[model samples]
Target: MALRHFFLILLVVSIWAFNNIAIKWGLLDLPPLMLTTLRFVVVALILVPFTRVNLHQLRYLAVLAFTFGFMHFSLMFISLNNTDAGTAAVIVQLGTPIAMLLAMVILKEKLRLVQLLGIAISLSGVVVLSGSPTIPNWWVLVLMLLSAFGWAISNMIVKKSPPISPLTMTGWLSFLAIPIVGCASWLTESDQITLLVNASWRGWFAILFSAIGSSIVAYSLWYSLLKHYNVNLIMPYSLLTPVLAVIMGVLVLGDSMNGFKVTGSLLVILGTAIAVINLRNLRMHAKLARFRYAGRSKGH
Candidate 1:
């Protein structure tokens, strides 16, 4: 990669990793479901007007939004509410391998063994991160793993489905998320508005960054990169999430990191680096498919 592209990857990955910290902190003040719902609503409102989509687009948006937006995140926040923040950060990285597996089955993409190893390595980090001298409940482990798969499946859906404008995809999916999560929130969470009103400005800032910066700006940039670059090259850098999460936790959240976190984080980072990176050719092949799809549409 060129020096500039390297930094672009760095910048985007930073945003994503930091978003985990943001979500964790936001949860301090808001219910997980309500906060997620609010974030997507903001993203949806901001992006919806920029692109024009017909009814056909609306249907596609609904599916994507439900799976990626509502279903995936609903599970995630529920899991987050139950698990430790540092541990949750590591667990979601499990999405890397899950995406690779799903991509092979659904998208018919080949997965290199190196990538498989990366997944295992990163996953070991989860094991290390989750259990202490005291083992956490197995239920928590299962829920966190489910959350990881949620994100991975969502990534696959985005990769496999017919291409749309990134903004259109982002906007509609987010907008659609509001009703499902909102109803869930309304039914389960009494005093929703009170929580919104009483939240500290810091919480509000976290919410805004997560809703707008991470979901809209960061995800938009990510989709653009995926549209233009090789995902394998990009996916490894996702390992950075746990790293950044630790930094943010210690620095901003005043969370402590123990020796296990250090060792596991190292293993995860090393595993991801070994498994997935240096895939310029892979990117070319993937985008060629996108180009072909675009061409077929024009001919029709």
Candidate 2:
């Protein structure tokens, strides 16, 4: 990528990193599931009128809704509600490595030696940080792991499925998720909507930002980069999310920092960098492609 595009990718990473902070702030006064419901509701309301889904591809979309929408957001929301956002962010960083393992086992993608080391590093970080008493009874830990799995599965489905604008995907998933999660909230909790009505303004503000900024705008930018940039270049930048999340949690959300969190955070960043940069050759090709695209546009 050109320096400009690289900087743009960095900007996108920063936005995503802030997403953890944003979501944590939103959950302050809002109930976990209920806040999630509102976030998706806004996303659906905004996106429904604009994008139409391909009915033929409903099967793939259904899978996306189940994994990405219902499971991922529900679990993450519940997890963040119970713990510090920084810790949740660090733990949720497991999704990338877990996805790699799934891709290797089921998709038969072979891992290079360095990639294997990266996996080991990430898993070690997970083991080091997971020794909290809160994890045993903490709904957040289990919920976050489920969210990560949902994300990984959805990623696999998205890889083979016919291309849809991420906007349409997010919208459909958000709309579809409403009833699924609403039913879940109803059955699991006594009444979540009541919590919505009773939530503070700060909570509502957080919900709106999570909907518009994190889910809608951040996702839109990310998929746009996927169109223009290679995954090798883009994926590494995503590691910034949890790092930013931890910083925001401490500086913004008042979560205290400790030695283990700092160490785990470093390991996660280092492992992600090792894995993503392992594709340096592909990244070169992607940069060349971006230049050709830009040159062609200028010629026109």
Candidate 3:
């Protein structure tokens, strides 16, 4: 990748990393469901205007909206209410493995031996992370895990659905999600009117950051990169997001990371790297390592 493209990836990763902290900040002032609902509402207003949807695929789109937009994000924000941002970010990475496994079953997609191992390693890391003593509540992790599963399911749905532009699907997802999530928040959450009326600037900033920065800006940039580069080249960089989130959580939220958290994070990241990072790159790196070793041996 060129230096500029590298920086662009870094920029998007940083924006997404900081998004975790923003969600935590927003949860302090706004109810989790309410905050999530408003985010979709804002995104819907902005992007729905430009998106074209096929009326014939409304059912699939609705399913995508429910699973991806409503269940995934709603559960995520609720999970973040008690869990630290860093932990939530790391745990959510499991969604990749989860999706792979679901594909194996639901879509009859075959998993290579390495892919199966990757899934095992990722799940083991989730176990280790959840077992850590630093976590205030276990249920928070459960909710986050469910959120990951919802995300996985949504991806599977998309895979089975008709071809549609990602941007258009996202706009429709947010547009559809607004009512589903908004009504749920209104029904379950109390004093939402008061919460909205009295919400501080920080809370609003968090919503805008999630909707604009993470969803619109980051996703748009990501699609642009995918357009130019091979997906394998582009995707491996995204693994940095959780690592960056962990660092941001420590610095901004003062969340403590003990040995277990560190170890689990390493396992999760390594396993995901194995799963998603192109095997071609692995072979190239291996060849380079051999060449370097031979040079050192010759010098000796």
Candidate 4:
């Protein structure tokens, strides 16, 4: 990957790290499903006018809307409401391995041995983080895992679907998700009108930031990168998200942290660095070997 693209991924990670905080703040004023509904509303209103999709693309987008937009966001928000942002962040990292496995099975992408080791190390970190005392409920863990599964499935859909601009994908996705999540909110949540009317600026800002920063900007870039790179390569960068989220959760949300959390954070970071750096080294070595082989062929 180019340095610019790497930095872009880092940017997405940073946005998402703060996104955990945003959702936590938003939950102060709105129910989980209601907050998700409003988020898609904002996204649809802004991007739908600019989006264009065909029947074929729409088929993929509809599934993506449900899986990524509805299932992932709704479950994630609910889980975040139940658990600390840091714990939720760590748990969601399970999506990394899930996506990698799906890429191998669905997209037929291969992973290096080192990559596998890195994934294992990262998962062990997640395991350690899962034991954090901050996680208040076990049911939230299950919800988060399901949410991560939904996310992994959505990634496969994005990779398999025909080429589409990131903007179109994000727009149609948000548009399609509105009714699904909206109905969910209607059925399970109450006081939507009252909440929206009385929501603080922080709550509203959370909605706007989640809609524009996390959805429009971060996801669009993420989709573009997915189109260009293998899932195994792209997914590891997300491990860094939990580390940032944990730190912010401690500072901003007053979430607890301990030696175990610190160890897990370091392990996650180490695993991610190993995956990225080793993959780059492998590519460079392959290029050098190819150049040498070409020189020998020309001489012969």
Model 4 error, position 17 (Å): 1.2
TM-scores for the candidates: 0.81, 0.88, 0.92, 0.82
Task: Output candidate 2 Cα RMSD.
Answer: 3.8
Give the local distance difference test score of model 4: 0.83
| Candidate 2 local Cα displacement, residue 223, angstroms | 2.4
Please tell me which model should have the higher lDDT, number 2 or number 4.
Answer: 4
Better of 1 and 4 by lDDT: 4
- Taking every candidate in turn, the Cα RMSD to the unseen true structure, in Å, is 7.5, 3.8, 4.6, 5.1
TM-score order of candidates, best first? Answer: 3, 2, 4, 1
**Which of the two candidates, 1 or 4, achieves a greater TM-score against the reference?**
4
Ranking by lDDT: 3, 4, 2, 1
User: Model 4: which residue pairs collide?
Assistant: none
Model 3: number of backbone collisions: 0
Per-residue CA lDDT of candidate 1, range 1-300, in tens?
447767777788788777777777778888888888888878877888787777866777777777777667776776666655566676666666677778888888887877778768877876776654222577767777777787787787776567787778877888888898889888888777999899987568767988777777776767667766666656666667777876776787676667776777677667656656646666676688689889989999
Candidate 4 TM-score, C-alpha based: 0.82
Deviation in Å, model 2, residue 57 alpha carbon: 1.3
Top lDDT: which candidate number? 3
Q: How accurate locally is residue 120 in candidate 1, as Cα lDDT from 0 to 100?
A: 81
Q: Candidate 3 residues 1-300, lDDT tens each?
A: 468888999999999999999999998889999999999988888888987878767789898888988779998999888878888898888888888889989899888889788778888888889777656687888888889999999989888888888778877888888888888898989998898889898799999999999999999898898887777778888899999999999999999989879988888888887777769766776687699889989999
